[model samples]
Target: MNTPQKAIALGIGAALIQALMLIAFAWPAANTAPRDLPLAVTGPQAAMVTQKLNQAVPGGFEITRPADEAAARTAIADREVYGAIVTGDGAPRVLVASGASPAVAQQLSAMAQQLSGARPAAVEDVIAADADDPRGAAFGAMVLPLVMAGIAGGVLLSLLVPSVSGRLIGLVGFGVVGGLLSMAIIQGWMSIIPGPYPILAAVAGLVSFAVAGTIVGLATVIGQPGIGLGALTMLLIGNPFSAATTAPEMLPQPWGAIGQFLPPGAAASLLRSVAFFDGAAATQPLMILLAWAALALILLGVGFLTSRGRTPASATTVSAEPVPA
Candidate 1:
């Protein structure tokens, strides 16, 4: 076997690995089903509503009984439940937080309709998706740009700015500017999302920094291979695992759990909370992003120390050379 053959084989192997990763992440999306999605039931007929919904889709909902429709609405706004059913003699009222998840809202509406039989349940979207993009497609689409911005920051900083301090400063600046610009376009100009620009921008900047810092840290420690690894983790694994297009519970086993911890998922959840859930659900996801950013900083520090240690020895070796020949 020659060098060329070895190189070809290695290239083929790398491609195969990428293909497998794509399949692993993408396959679950096609097979999504509701699993323990939260819902609130209220009033005297709560028991019947719960029973019927559970019968319709077993293990699909974690049903809670609120005192009345007002409480149900509060639960939805607080991100306690994805949707709610207020049972009454005339007709059942289904309250959904479409701003949290349009997919979940649509599914819940359908389920309510099925349970109502001939008469359709009255559905109300308490926190609807943005007026411009009512389906919430913009939220899902935003993930790609966030990921790209992070990648650009990481790669460009690493290449253009050689020093550790310079790279860090550059990445931070890039993240802040990029985040603000994105908010201006999405919220200010387009009016796709509502106000609270400062909070939104901060969350976006945090997400970008978390992702970019992780990539830069990995690359500093592992050289060229680190860049590929960063991409594989953030892009291939993080995006689909995020379940941005659908509720996390809708994803097949383990994936939903996995996605929640990733940067992209955390960011998406944070944005949704700020935009519609009144920032009630932001804490956990914010913690996740902060943890990632902290770990990346630690890794970067380690890389800096290791490189500094190697420099003196490298210089000594260069100086001590010229031993006869």
Candidate 2:
């Protein structure tokens, strides 16, 4: 095609992708995840506990069978888990941990009571998050590290995609994970203002890989422009609505309900569940994030079918040879 044709195609294609990313991904990620979180548990040995626990999630957790109340208390202090369970005869009681999450702590009491069949879940939110913190921020805290790390990873990939050493992509991923853990220490122990440091770092690392992979995939599908699109999609579209600070539940209707499907919202909710809710509420959010990641990878594969360069980013250009349909 001539210069004019090429420019038109690029504009149309860019517009199309941007529109999809915004409508399908970024728009929703922001609206569902909450900031302040209430963390706790009912019966530690509640027979159904393990049954529920077996259901794995993408959020953070450390499930342990503590011996007694004292042991559970120590575990919360160590941050072994967000809260603890002390199994007893009637039902069970929750123990709140000052260091855990306050929103969860407050809500656990009422929620626990509601959960118990004979009585209730016997809520006892242990490990209180800070007063200034919002339940939505709890989710944000978990996702912030991941988003920041992913942002860094996206930038790094942009630099490395044009370079000779392709394997460095993997190296970059590893570095992101390392940075996440390191940041966690700084956030958690150092008393970072926003939220817990260590947890944020962990989430940041996870988000880094997911975002980097998406960026990589988009670059493959659209070449250099994918990087720009990724920024617009992941950062602009995903972050703001990603927390309960402005979740759909509080909103009037469908917009609020639909937010959880967005990338940031999914990850934020998953992280918040882990950070404040003892990972109790992570089932769907994890699935949403995985689905988005999978779709991005599929796009990357399609891009790879037609490109010629050694770098993955080159595949994104549309004029390349046909990917075997």
Best by TM-score: 1
Tell me the tens digit of each residue's lDDT in model 2 across 26-121.
555443332222122334464454334334221222356666677777666554454655566766676764334444444444434544457765
Q: In lDDT terms, which candidate is top?
A: 1
Give candidate 1's TM-score: 0.92
Model 1 C-alpha lDDT per residue in residues 205-246, reported as the tens digit of each score: 888998998888888888768777886788877888788878
In model 1, state the lDDT of residue 281: 82
Looking at model 1, residue 9 earns an lDDT score of: 99
Model 2 scores a TM of 0.49
> Where does candidate 2 have its weakest 10-residue lDDT segment?
32-41
